[model samples]
Target: MRSNHSASRVVWTLTLCTSLALLGDSTLYAVLPSYHPAVGIGVVQVGWLLSMNRLVRPPLNMLSGWLSQRLGPRTPYIVGLSIGALSTIGYSLCRGFWPLLAMRALWGVAWALLAVSAYGLMLDVTVESTRGRLAGIYTSISYFGGALGAMGGGFLVDALGFSPAMFILGALSIGASLLALTLPRTQHLPARHVAPGVSLAWRPRLQAWAHALRRLDARLWLVLALSFAHRFLFAGVFYSTFGLYLQQTLGESLHVGAAVIGVASFTGTVLFLRNVVSVLVGPGLGYLSDVLGERSRVLLLGEVLGVAALACLALADSLWISAAGVLLAAMAYGIVPPMLVSWMGDLTRTGARGTIVGGYQTMGDLGSGVGPLVAYALAAAWGLSAVYGLGAALCALTVPLILLVRSRAAGRAPLAVADHGAHGA
Candidate 1:
């Protein structure tokens, strides 16, 4: 058994590690669409490169979960961090569509290993009483790396060009991997069975997967749906297209007095602002959900805010108005993720939680993966505003589903956050 203080340290360390690992990935999001041609890719290939890692994450998520269950989080976490650093290095050196695509896919594998292990480890060490706050803490600190990555990466790219910027960040990522060596070798002891004569038993390779699938109930299904919808719009479409949209609306460079801001620099600043808001609100909103004793309510409000933000962003022709939309969107991004993960914590136990979290993340990955492809294709056909409008509509459609989950929870006996019964699925 772990003490709260020890668990808290673990959560913080894991979060910080992930934050560093994310430097390359988030920086790419900030610079890629605009710099696509600089890296030997056409405009049409931009979305594919942006989303390739995500597209490969679904299966990798499952693999990460199973590995976490069998070997504990420490090993995979270290390995993932190493891979992430290598992939960043690859990004710095590689050119052309195929090479960049391969690096993106490699990053996907890294994320799967890091994310599932972190979530599983958090659950293993913390209780219901501490889960929400720790989750909030995890989210808050995790985005610090993203915030820096976007802002610094843009400045670096603008000042030193793409390869140098990436190489510098990749070196930093290697430092993060070294930091992981201090973590305990085994966080969650793998469950084992021993019997007098039961050596004759047989277990299939995918038995864990089958069991995880069988465990999904209506509430779990709702979690998956919410994860899918939220990521599709927020991380997927919005992240992939926001730079292009900015270029279209604001032009290649913005001249404010003596200062000239290129599209990548401006995009990075906006992205940095968005992530700063996420860092600021992630913990507070998570604590709010804990205080309210209902993650669903907080999530519902965030979803609605997402709808409004998208609409605002779609129509805003002025800078301040667009900033407002970005602010709202940031709040939505911060609020939804921790609450959704905590809600999953509410509905699951340690035994099945790893696989279940994997499933949830896989759905999110699938949505994010498909989102960039769809958004780019649609934006080309119908214009960026229409694509934003479509995102708003999709966000709006998720509201009723969240309400249903809230109502169902209200009508039934509240599921205990730390319930270890066989009810988990």
Candidate 2:
């Protein structure tokens, strides 16, 4: 599969974009939790700020997906990369309460635009035979990028200054944008390309939305449900709670928190891996997913290990314990996402590729936004410990849901139309 030249080009370019974008994006989480107190805000406000960045994604994803085939992956890919570069620069230059919040809100849109386009493009290059390995490779690249960004962002702030670090990262992102232009011009063709008379008026967009909604099947809903739960626990409750645990409970400083957060938090590649097992073992694990031919089983095995690891992380009072937990969890966490993406690719049609990925991401984003708020609420009511405990439960809950999901059904031949009159499928 690595011998496939076109797929190789896709991976490297996509990997470069993921690395550079994450390098810039990682700067925010590097400082945000500890910086919150410096700015005279509290836990709840911090969660709100974090959630604000995720809140706008669902609708934007839908719109981006709807428009993807029309504009082609190339256009959005360029636009998204540009926005990512600018937004990191925005984080560096902005301050004050409302201004900062507004900036975060805007970054949310930039993130969705960039991510949906990347996912759409990744899928564009391969069919089902290559899907599992490609998905694994793509995710592996993202994880590796995230680790570099997390470590680099912290080291940069320490070596130079916040603004300087951001500027460097933003410039890298811009370079990746340029690299995107070099992607092979001949690739996946749109099932329906944009015509001259195409219009994005509200009526048509709304109709498309309604038509798409009616097309949703039991399998997609199950995947979305699994996606939602995965993010809600991992992204929301676990993230907000863990930062408080490290800072207040462990009495660590910002730098310590940044290093450890990536290890403990389930959310983004914001995780900086001191856990060497994941890095060393990543390719093998990815290969296992491809070889097994049963993604849900591999996914479930990882989830089980991840949930157990999260519990250990919650109670870890020493660095070694924390490292151990992170190592175990990383092994599992690394497997699940790529498997899920592969599964979705197996489920989707050529025409609805972007829309399906968009919906998948949209649900994940919703969980990301709502998860933190829910964690905050749980923390407020039960205590910070409860958030991790409940989050573990949520992770466990998804395994059953994964089992409930029927194996991926591909092509239009097997799919029954939900509303033939509306979509004319």
Candidate 3:
């Protein structure tokens, strides 16, 4: 993204690209849990497949941060997208467990590069005060696109065969990559590094962060901790296990292609509906966060609702009850991120945006990795329901931390001033 581009253009372009990428990838992700087991992979091993991205994310995140400075966000964005396209194609043809695992790992690298570049691009196009609103818009598109993508992929898989469905999804990524070529160049992110904003040596950079972390205030630390836990529940437990749970709940399993698709497709539709809630509610939440300037209250509410969502999932007696839970969870998911990122934006500096966002994402990555591995082990020892119960407890524990965010004078005093100042008519 060229920093000089119109915000509208950046928003639409980025949103569209994000949608395409997720739409393509979610198809594969939505199916893979059951698909893997059908092909003879073990349940514990499925956790590894779901989480292969985490293996490369920590280091790659740092590298992408540094790399984006030198090469510009556009270069990595395009290259990473190209790889995403190829990876989807790889999934279509690869049959061996090891090869598929490697592809999943490669997708992780692509994701790291894409996320660092994309989020940095977001920071470039907006001011600190405007972050909540913009972050909400971005998150809305991300979730909305994800919803459409997963739903589309599910139906396609249901109608066509798996390989054919993958081919179609792969093509979507290719199309998105081509569309990315038309993106306007960014001035904040120049084509090549004119200044040394980032260190090339990883060790020195790592050491620098080690020293720099001591200066953070209590609230920032709390945000990071919450990020880790929230993502843990999201990536590790919910996503990795949800499909399997559905299968178990419905008494469906591997090799029964149509029956399996019926169950998976239903879950995909539920996810689609949840994302729709995100799309509908996201803008309003973003606006609320900006007006209140007190992101903590909004964030805390989201956490509380998250606990409730988990409870619904854990103790669900019927699909309707689970759907209600999903709606609650989705709304909470929609609500918190804009406030979280906006709140974090307030705490950090523009110069440190790259590192802060990178670190923040890495925290989520850590949660995602740990959440699933532990969930898989626990579920194996216990059952799927245990994972949701634990998730609810952890989410409950984080509400207090979110409560500690000190609201800005702008947040506490008068929102009308903020309404005009942050978003001009």
Candidate 4:
């Protein structure tokens, strides 16, 4: 019963952290585009501003992980949440794009600190067998918060105006900050150092990070590549431009676009229920991978299915059709987190998990940052449909790369496979 209660608390803590992390992203989407048009920025330029938020994540993530290792995860987590809460309120005071962009960059730093610390904590508390499922739950809570923030922000913006909406988001973030304070304090192990009295230079950390990256098996790199492409396409087109697309292509109002996206996010959160299924099935899948020796094939198959879903979005003509496509994409999207993170855990030593995962997330942030610019350029040249088509194609390409990795790892023992299968994988 004690153990069960502890598990429950961990789950709640992770959920709350994820929700807080997502709030800024959700509210930014809600407030930015409408404000942009009101202030005379064109549709394309707005995409750039959205991309700016993601741009700050990679570097900050690298720093946050090191800081967490030194300071303990909870401090940075609390500080990040506080910053996010304050920044959300700051958005309302901004008069133009530059100020808003600056605020978003700062928000990205907060997101990185909180997200890296939260994930590190999640990993610390969870066992290997259950990792996949917990990742699903974490992501689900994130999307759910996104859905609520988007929906609530939209309604609030329509009813109360942008300033009030920002204030409300700020208040919610502060609430999350309060909740963050209750998280169990993590005990840090003694640091493993390379040399005594190495000054506070990032060079050693950067080199260590590079070595970790190099240590990633070719198959893992492929998975990372696929993840990169997936993020690039999604961030660039769907996330960055979807609102503008609805406005220009569908003749929808800003409120309507936010509603559609919010509803889509809610739909995506619903799909995360499958993570509960993933928790049940994830171990089975890991066991099956151990049994059949075809983990890569399973991953490839999932990626292929995701590609098809992206293609469906590309072909979608109506809003309903596009939404259906999103649902399909969500299904595929939901499957990857558990399997991929678990696989990474399988590959790395216990000591390096935080650093390695932080690096992977940094790469993800890099992909996310690049995605928007790429999509914006593509959209400027071709069309929105073309962007979707490219995303679909990229998803398809990842399958073969995943296959290559699977084939390579097939002969190796599953060293990292957990005994009881903790939920952090």
Pick the lDDT winner.
1
Write one digit per residue (lDDT tens) for candidate 2, span 1-425: 22356665686688778778777656667666666654456656775676677777789997777666556566677787788778777766765566667767777777777787777766666555565676767776675776677777878877886667777887888898888877643233345456899866889878997987787776667767777776676655654565566555445433454464433343233244522444545445556766775556777877887787677766777856765666766676566666677767656654356777788889888887778778788778987666676667767777776666544443334231121111110
Per-residue CA lDDT of model 3 for 173-202, tens digit only, reads 888788877664443323434366764677
Q: Which ten residues in a row have the lowest lDDT in candidate 4?
A: 416-425
Clashes of each: 1, 3, 5, 12
Residue 393 of model 3 has an lDDT of: 91
In the range 193-236, model 1's lDDT, one tens digit per residue, is: 76877563356536864785686666778888889988999888
Best by TM-score: 1
* TM per prediction: 0.83, 0.78, 0.78, 0.76
Cα deviation in Å at residue 71, candidate 3?
4.2
Candidate 4, residues 1-425, lDDT tens digits: the string is 11435544775676776675566568666566666676446677687776776777887787887776666667788898888887888877775777777878888888888887777666555554455555556655565666566766777778887777787778888888888777765544456565866565798778986886677677667656656766666644566666555555456332454465444444334344433343444444444444443445556655776777668767877867765666555555555655666566566443335555667678777777777778889889988788888888877777766666666666776545332322331
TM-score attained by model 3: 0.78
Q: Show the colliding residue pairs in model 3.
A: 2-185, 2-186, 3-186, 3-187, 236-372
List where candidate 4 sits over 4 angstroms from the true fold. Answer: 1-5, 36-49, 92-99, 187-189, 192-213, 241-298, 314-324, 349-351, 379-387, 414-425
**In terms of TM-score, which candidate is stronger, 3 or 4?**
3
**CA shift at 256, candidate 2, in angstroms?**
14
Q: lDDT (CA) for every model shown?
A: 0.81, 0.66, 0.71, 0.65
**Residue 106, model 3, lDDT:** 84
Model 1: what TM-score?
0.83
Residue 2, candidate 1: how far off, in angstroms? 4.5
